[model samples]
Target: MEHRIATFLSRLSRTWLAAAVLAAVAIASATPAPAQDFITVASTTSTEQSGLFKHLLPEFKKATGIEARVVAVGTGQALDMGRKGDADVVFVHDKVAEEKFLAEGFGVKRLEVMYNDFIIVGPKNDPAGAKGKDVVEALKKIAGTSTPFTSRADKSGTHAAELRYWKLAGFDPPKGAWYRETGSGMGPTLNTASGMNAYALTDRGTWLSFKNRGELVILVEGDTKLFNQYGVMLVNPAKHPHVKKDSGQKFVDWVVSPAGQAAIAAYKIDGEQLFFPNAKP
Candidate 1:
C-alpha cells in the first residue's frame, strides 16, 4: 500500500508540472510581439533643427509603420556615418559628397530628396556691407572688410558651400582674426553668429526656424550657387552585412514618393514653407 501511494504521488506531481508548463507556454504565446521595426538614418542638422523631420517623420511612420531614427549632424558627418555602417540610410545636402560616398561603395544609390537655398545672415545694421542678392559678391565684401564672420568649419555641407563661395569670390578659405570657425552644427553656429553679430551662411530652413535672431537678419539670398540640394541613399548592405536594407530602402523609396513629397511641401512655419520637395516622380 505504501508503494502504491508513492507511485500515485509521483504521477500527480508530473501532471502538475505538465499543467504549469502548458500554462507558461500559453501566457508567452498570448504576449504582445516586440515592435522594434526601425531604421537609423544619418541626416543633416538642417532637417532636424529646422523642424522638417518633426513634421516629415511622423507621416513616414504612419505610411510605412517603420520608425526612422535620425542622427542629425552635418552632411559630412552623416556621410561618414554611412561609410562606417553606423547608419542604415544617409540623407544629406551635398550632392558631390553623396556621389563620392556612392563611388566609394559605401552607399547603394543617391536620390534627390529636396532642395532649399542658403542665405547669408548678419547683423541688422549690415556692418560688413554684405546685404545683397548676390551671394558670391556679398561674401567678397565681407572678406574684403575685416568684418567678423562666423563659419561652421565642421566640414559641413554649408561650410563647404561657404568655402566654395569664397573661392568663387577669389578668396582662399579666408582665415584671420576676422574669421571665426565654429566646429559645430548649424543651430549652434547660427547662435554663435548671433552672439558675435558675425556674418554667417545658413540654409533658409534653419534661418527660418531660428528664433534667437538678436540683431541678425537675412543679408544675402537668391543666388544660384546657394542652392542646397538634399539627397537620400541607403547604406550598402553587402558591405555591412548587418544593415537594415529593406527598411532603409523603404524609407528612400517613400521619401521620393508622391505622398512624401506632398508631406514635405505641407510642412510650414507660420504658413511659410520650410523645405520645397523636389523629388522627381
Candidate 2:
C-alpha cells in the first residue's frame, strides 16, 4: 500500500510539471514582440492624395525591412505633430514652417525631397477670366470679380502658399460668398471647387491624380511663384526620447537615397510625372 501511494505521488508531480510547462509556453507564445521595426511619419495630404506614399513606402520596406506608417495631414499639422512628439518624422512642403521647426529644435534637419508646382484650377468656361494669366493676377481677378473661388483655409502648406500669393497681390481677400474657405485637404477642397464650379489653387500632383475633375482645367500655371518644394526630417530624439530614432533616420535616409529618388521619379499618372525628385542630399 505504501509503495503504491508513493508511485501515485510521483506521477502527480510529473503531471503538474507538464501542466506548468504548457502554461509557460502558452504565455510566451501569446506575448507580442516589440514593435521597434516600424516608424510613424507625419506628412502632407498632397503626398497621400498623389499616391506617392503608396508607391514609395513599399519599396522602402522591401529594401530596409522597416515599415513606415504614414499619417497624412497638412504641412502645418505635420510640423505640429513633430513639435509635440506625436510623429517620428515629418514630410511636408512648407519651407518656412519646416525651417522654423528645425530652428526650434523640434527636428534634426530639413532635407529637400521633391517638388511640384501649384496650379490654379478653374472651370472650362473660366468665368473669372483667370485662364492664361499670372497666378497673382488670377487671384486678383477672382477676388475682384467675386467669381466663387474656393480657398483651402485649413492652414496647409498649400494654404500657406495661397496666402502668400494673396499677400503679394496686395489685397486681403474679402470674406464673403465669393471667397469660400473649405477647411479641408487638397483633394476635398478640389472636389468642393469642382462641385461649386469655382476656382482653386492646387498642387499639380493632386490635380493629376484627381478623377472627379468635372469640367475643371488647369487655368493658371508656369509662374515661378507657383513653385512648391517638399522637405523631410526626422523628429528630434533629444526632444522626444520615445521617438524611434534609428528607424526614423533610416526612412529619412532611404527617401533621399538614389533608389528612393528613382522611385519618386518613376511614379506618374497617365505617363505624366507628378513629382520631380530634386533631393539635395
Task: Count clashes in each candidate, considering only residues at least 3 apart in sequence or on different chains.
Answer: 0, 0
Model 2 clashing residue pairs (backbone): none
The all-Cα superposition gives candidate 1 an RMSD in Å to the true structure of 2.7
lDDT of each: 0.92, 0.93
Q: Which regions of candidate 2 deviate over 4 angstroms?
A: none
Candidate number of the best lDDT:
2
Q: Which 10 successive residues of model 2 have the least lDDT summed?
A: 168-177
In the range 4-69, model 1's lDDT, one tens digit per residue, is: 999999999999999999999999999999978999999999999999999889999999999999
Error of 1 at 173 (Å): 1.4
| Worst lDDT 10-window in candidate 1 | 167-176
On TM-score, the candidate that comes out on top is 2
